[model samples]
Structure formats: C-alpha cells, structure tokens
Target: MNLYLNLPSYGTIPVVNSKNQTPNSNVLTQITSTTSPFITKANGNITIRQSFWQPVPNVIRYTYKYLGNNQFQRLHTDPHSNLITNSNFPDTVFSNSVTYSGRLIGLILESPHEEEYHSILTSMIPIAPAQSQNATGGVIDREIEKLLEIFSLQQVAIPKTFQTDEIIHIVILNPIPYQTSLFHIHQRALKGTYCTLRNNVWKCIWNIPNVRSDFHSVLNRFSSNDILINCCTSQLQPILHTWLQNLPHTSAPHLLKGHHPSTLKMKGRWYQTIN
Candidate 1:
C-alpha cells in the first residue's frame, strides 16, 4: 500500500513506524505489540487501521474515503470522518483550513515475506485562519507607525538580508490591551512571522515570545504561551508604563512609547527620567 502525507509550509506531519503491522491468518494471536514497529502476519491479506496523532494548524473536520481490493475488480467506498472539535485552537479568534491523509503500508523492511494492502480511506478538511479586523482609522495609523518603526534603522539594529523565500505581509487586529503582546508580535515579525497591530485589535500567524526580560517576566506571570493578554482600558496606560520601565535599557521602552506625537520627549533623551 502507498501512504501519502502533505502539509502547508508552516505545518509538520508525523509518520507511524511499521512495528504495528499484523498478519492475516491466525484466528487469535498477538499480531504485534502496540509499541513495536514491526507486525506479524497470520494468514494472507490483513487490514490494519490507524489514526493521526495531532491536528494541523487550520484543520477542522475531515472525511476519509478509499477503495477496497476485490476478487474481480477494486471496490471504492466512503469509510468515515474525523471531527476535531476537541482539538484546542491557540486563540478564540483564530480559524483555519487544513487536511491530512493516511494509508496502510506493505513494507517489511527486512522481512522477506512482507506484503502490502492499500486502504480505501482518505481525508479532506477545511478550517479558517485566525483573523480580526479594526474599524478605526486612528487604530490603522497606530499600526502603520508601528510598522514604520519596525523597519526603521534605529529600531531594527540588525540588517535583514533580502530573500525571495521570505513571506512578508502585515495585518492589523483590534483590541490590543497589553504592550507585552506588542513586544512579542514585533519580535516574531522580524523573524518572518506575519503580524499586525491596530488601536484595539491584533492578529498573527502565531504570537512570538518577547526575548526582552522586561516584557517576558510580566507575561510569564500570566501566560508563558504567546496568546493575547486582555487588559481593561482603564489599566492600559499604567501597565504599559510599568512594563516599559522594567526593560533592560530605559531607552527601548521610551522609544516604543514616544513613537506617538504626543508622547515624544521634549528636550533630552527619555532615559534620563528613569535614572
């Protein structure tokens, strides 16, 4: 039997080892151990079944169909479907479409008598990518400014070598409550993760972690994972300032905040205030 596996550029697929293969004959015999990679044959043709271990990024429910071998000709039929409502989504806002395929194999590797049987089951699923949209142009401006600084010489100390394989895209999400999330999102974008920030919303392929101790420590108290941390509007400013002050160097936080016209320091560098 031929086994086929496919995934998106960002996803990974795992193949099962052949230790579980069993033979056709023996009326009642231990074909193979669960942990074992090799299977034993009982009679002539044995049918083995298996399932995928994990769900892909945007996979929802999937349908599997396949063809069966017959005396005269091969018979095709619809077998079953696997539903993934139990699988966890990284965030409440994200959705996606993903599909995976599984099949039985006949390879004995070292066994001289190994035979293969093809399955009649295949799967297809559709899922939505996590998404969010901002209605406020003011929010969009905040987003554009952030992007500018992201690409700015002062903000990006390291030079980015251009590569055709790199995918660069920007998307703005509404309801950004904490600066910690912004810190992570920015780091991820630099590393090739597409992310966008607007006045109130935020979205991305994945939340990148903040390497900066100031931001990382705060997030660690709540969640170590890169999900958005929602904060009340009333607490936004104070929390942001607190986090900014905790950064390794006072200048970094100030620069992040001072990007706004109203927040720009007047006379000297803003780092003096922290000293």
Candidate 2:
C-alpha cells in the first residue's frame, strides 16, 4: 500500500511508509569484524538489550493543578455548529506538547513523546484492508481520528475564551474519554496481532475508530506520568531518548503550543504540533 504513483512533494497527499517492514524484531546484533578496510569497526554502536521487550510508553497522565470544570467553561459540543468556543486554551496557549510533558524528559524514552492519538491522527491513516475494498465502511480511519479530535476538544478542555480556572481557561480531565476510546480503537494500527495470522495480516490490521493526539494529551495533562522519578522509572533514558529522536517526522508540524517550567533546561530544536 506504500505505492508512490502520486508525487507527495507539494503535499498532494500524505506521504506514507511504503516499506513492508516493522520494528517487531527482538534483535541483538554485534559487529565483531569489518570487511571494509576504509571503515573502522565500532562495538558501542550496537545496542545490548537484555530482552526483546519494547517499552509500552506510559502516555496517560493524572497530574493537574485542577480537575474537571463544569463551572464557567462550556463542556458541551458546538450548539449552532462545530467550532472551538475558546481559543486561549493551553493546547493553543503554551505552544509545545502542552504543559503536561514538562518534567517527562527523563521518562520520555519509556513513554514516547506523542500520544497514540497524536501519532496516528496527525498523519493520514493507512487504508484498512476492508475499507480499501469499499465493501464496508465509507470513511477512512485518518478522517475519523481528525473528526474525533475536533469533536472532543471542548469536552475535556473548555472551549470558552474565558473559563473556570483561576489560572487559565482550560480544564484537565482525569480520565480522557476521547483518548481511551481511541486507544481501544487504534492502539494496534501500525503493528498488531490477531488470534490468527494470514498472508495479508501485515497489509490490513490498523482498522479502528479515531481520535486526535491533542485532546488526549489534554486528558493526560494532569496525569501522574509527569513527576521525574528516575529511581522508579528507569535509568535507560539516554538510549530511549535516542530511539525516539530517530522516529520519522511528519512533513508539516501542527505548531502545537506547550509551555512548562522544566523544558527550558533542555536543548535542541523545539517542535510544537497538535499531533
């Protein structure tokens, strides 16, 4: 399905991962010798994993300066038509991955930077095997994800320009209905396993309902994943951080707004995107 018939330079369509490969391999390779005389052999480049287990990043967070707000904020969807009632919320305010991830630089390796919703929804979803056939669903998965994000933006985070918080207009939800629902739907989109594996298992797997990354990130805004507890989370932050940095970047950034205290101490480019 990674066919390149159509050019993707000018954003004609979402660029896709056409390569038929997955990172499921639990591998440990050691370079003992080098055949090329021009190249020097390096042993530290190879990773030494104790096991093949890939970390299932703890994306959900429960920490919050405040919780659900039914007060001055509007939690309901668009009344007349769909539109964001409040534009000053932190997702649009702070301009990074939101304020929740400020202290997670240490745990980032164990838990990826972007939530599951952010990962799948921002990018064009791969066509499901059944959907590709068009014998079943009408809409594609990516559209479903995008629409869900737009739909839930107001539920957890109040859309009103002015809100209940003494500090800010946004509200943080303890349990993100939007994110949980999406995780239930598309957690295994890129790589999943059913009870049975057929010849086309790899081709068509990630067929689930959708949600946006931002909405879910808000859900996790006040979550417990923020505290920096290296004694508890693990000491392997460096390797995991390296792995995450290597993940492919979407061509266009959503210009996500995130502002937090600790992020100031870190280095390198600061990318803020909704996805």
Candidate 3:
C-alpha cells in the first residue's frame, strides 16, 4: 500500500518509518563515519567517479515489467534475489536493480531527531470532482483560497508553528538520469516492469558494494530540487468512498491523473521524505 503523500511547492511527504517514527540518524552517522576514511570530501561535497543506481518509487512501491503477454507477472529483478532474500521466492530485494542494499544518503539539510511533533492536523476538505480534477501546481493553491472563503476557514490548525523538522542531504553518488535509474520498493517494484529487462531488473545484484569501500562520489551533491515524487495508477474509488463517509466535510482528498511508472520521468537519487 502507498503511504507517501505528494504536495505541491511544499514538496511531497517522504515515506516514514512505521508509526511515523523518525528515521534513525545513528544508522546514517555510523555508515558515513565507517566509510569516511575511504571517501574524499572537499567543500562538504563528495565527488563521484562512477555512476550508481539510486532507489526511487514507482506507482505504489513495486517495480514490475509486463511479459510478452502484456500480463503483469513477477519477473526476476536480479539473479541474486535468491541470495539476499534467503528464500526461494522471487520478491525479496536487497538493493535496487543497480546496486547492493544500502540506506539512501541525504546530506543534513535539517537535523534528524532534533525534535518531534505530537501530530499535524491537516484537514483536507473536498471539492467537486470537476473543480478538483482541474487543480495542479499553483492552481491548487488558488482553489484552496476559494474554498477557505466559501467555508469561512482560515487555517489547518491553531497555535500555528511551522517546522522543517525533517530533511538531510545524502551525498548522492554518480547518479544517472531519471529515465534509467533504480526504483525504491519493499516487496516488489510498483505497477508493472519498466517494459524492458534492463530497466526493470537489477543490473548488479551480485556486485553490490560495501559502503565503506565501494561508493563513488559525484561532482556535485543533489538538492531537494532534484528530488521528484513518483506515483502510479490504481482504482481508488473504494478508498475515496470510505474517506467521504469518514473524513472531514463528508469528502475525500482529490487525486490527479496517475500514470504508470513506464510513463514517468522521476529524476535521479529519488527518495521520499516524511512530511
């Protein structure tokens, strides 16, 4: 099931640990320190010599490819799925289709675990389908303003305090373009495969590197602007119906047109952040 939320301008919410626990800073710290001796950092930027595959999300969180039959079936993502998964099953993934498993790197744009919020109460009031469907980017902002006027609503919550409590920069290594990068997933790649084997399957499943030794730096670091959110298509009527019955204003959130991963051009070093 998809857990990430994509918001315009504000940026989409990255995947969070279950129950919204903060991602462990210690884990990132340890990995970087242990590997620092081998990495050369200049001007706080670690340069890259070789390109690497970064994990990104497909629609939903699984990577897939359609067989010649055009049927979405489990195609093998890599030859070593049997190894890292330690099962005869074909779904376990150790790394993306391009490299061995390692946590994504995000440089410290903001400190991790610096503080925590009890909750964020964002009430998404719904609008007519025609009006909602027409909204995107800045247009959505204007629609919200209109809704606020109609409803006499001013803010999402009281005692307003905004905190950019999340975000860190991982020195994204030599990242290839968005079209051919690795995807982020847990059980499988989202939707169907990339329609091609190399685009869908892990190219270096058996040749994953030791973080301390194998990482190659990039000439520059990736910024939040380089991050792109990915989504896929699914019939959401059931969930939308449920939300209309249970959520605020007797309505569910609006959705944009969802295209398959094969059609998306989400940029490199793609990783989601929790909002």
Candidate 4:
C-alpha cells in the first residue's frame, strides 16, 4: 500500500520507511491492521483520527489549509477532546503575513501559547522616538492662553524679578470661578512646585531649578507672565486690570493693585503680583 502526504500547491511526498526505502511487510501490516482511525483523505486536506496503536501521547494536531495562491488558514484541535479551539491568528502576525509567506505557518501552538507568541512578536516591532518635555510644555502653554482668550480673561505681565531659579510667587487677580480649570492647565504646562487659592485669588510658587540651556537667554529677556501677555490681545488688558481692583481687600498689604507699580517694590524679590 502506497501512502502520500500532500501539501496543496507544493506537490506530494511519498511515505516511506525509516531508511528512505519502500515500506516492508511489517510496516504494511501495522498500517493495515491498526484499528486507529487515521487520515482517510489522500488530498491536501488534513483528517485527524484516534488510534490505540499509536505511540505518541497527548499531541495536538494542527492543519494548515491553502486558501488561494499563497494565502492560508490555520485550524487548531485539542488532543484529549479532539475539538477545534482558536483558529484566528494574532492581530500583528495576521497583518504582516499578507505579503510574507511562512511567517505564521508553523506558529500554531496549543492553548496558553498566545501570550508567548505576543511577547516574541512585540520584540520584533519598531519603537517610536519620544517628544521633548520643553516642546510639550510650550504646546500646553499655548492651549492655556487660548482658553483664557475664549473665556475673556485678563492676561497679566509676569514680574521681571520672578524669572530666576529661586522660588517665584504669582498672583492671579480677579480669578474667575473656574479656578480649578486654570490651576490644572498651569500645573500641566509648568509642572509648578505648589499652588493655592487665597482670598478668591490664585497664588502659586514655582521652583524650577534645572532651566534649559537653550531657554536661558529667552528667560532673561521675558518672564513667564510677559510671554503670556504677549500672546494675548491688547483689548483684554484694561478689562483684566479693572477686574483686579474690584477683588476683596485690593488695598491689603499682600494684595497688589493693578494701577500702581510702586506698591510692588515693598514685597520681597520672590513675591510677584499679576493683575
């Protein structure tokens, strides 16, 4: 009896003895007399069957079917239950396997194998470069300015003394009721050390020790508030100043009025007022 293992579109291979010769009488007898329900089809189709005479134990069988010219489909079957389990390939592998043959051919394994396959394939994927923090912060600052403009909020000029490496104090005058949103935006943009609400105003202290070398000259020329004011329209400045004076305790020692620049000198160098 001649036996053949056929691979679709790849032709067939004749089943022979261990020595690459024709099957002897003993091998033929074993093949014929065996009660095992072996493969019944001679075509490329895989037909798995059970047999008591088989030596191998607990071995799950997998069938690779050629769908067309080069495309193929895989089927996995459990050994003990003989039921077909998951048949679909992983997302990454199936996507890349379109143009490349033999990529996912022999990758079909039993249960608990998906994780291992994903781990191996993850290492093969290319990694993208990360964005610089300064660039990200700059974008966030612009967003805050846009939000302020949308809400008709005043843009204050940052004090020159507060631009240094030391702890810098900022005063937000007539802070809108949406103080939380502003606080979150500032935190995200500057990553400030600390911020708080006092007398319905927003006061924050930012301690930036490691200033970027590229921004050193720019920082010396303009404070953070100055940059923010430059981004705003000229029409909003006077309205913002008027709102500051109307705030509670506008004449208080800690509170700096927007109209007067002389009162600001009384505060220490770290203290900076924003209207």
Q: Which residue pairs clash within candidate 4?
A: 158-225, 158-226
Worst 10 residues of 1 by lDDT: 105-114
Candidate 1 wrongly placed segments (more than 4 Å): 1-165, 169-238, 244-255, 258-275
lDDT of 3 by residue, 1-275 (tens): 22222222223233233254432343223323433222233452332111222221111111223222213232244454332232112222212334322112221110000011111122112111111112221222222223222212222221212112222111211121111211211112323332221122221121123321221222112222222111221232232223223423221222222222222232111111111
lDDT of 1 at 111: 6
Whole-model alpha-carbon lDDT for candidate 4: 0.23
* Per-candidate local distance difference test: 0.22, 0.22, 0.22, 0.23
Q: Which candidate model has the greater TM-score, 2 or 4? A: 2
- Can you give the TM-score per candidate against the true fold? 0.20, 0.18, 0.16, 0.17
Quality of model 2 by C-alpha lDDT: 0.22
lDDT at residue 217 of model 4 (Cα atoms): 23
Give per-residue CA lDDT, model 2, range 94-161, as digits (tens): 12354532222111211111132223322322111111212111121112223223313442232222
lDDT of 3 at 201: 23
Cα error, residue 135 of model 2, in Å, equals 51
Give lDDT: candidate 3, residue 205. 22
Q: For model 3, state the Cα shift of residue 43 in Å.
A: 47
Candidate 3 overall lDDT versus native = 0.22
lDDT of 4 by residue, 128-204 (tens): 11112233112322232232232122243323222112221111111111121121111222122211111111111
- The alpha-carbon RMSD values of the candidates against the true structure, listed in the order shown, are 25.4, 18.8, 23.6, 34.5
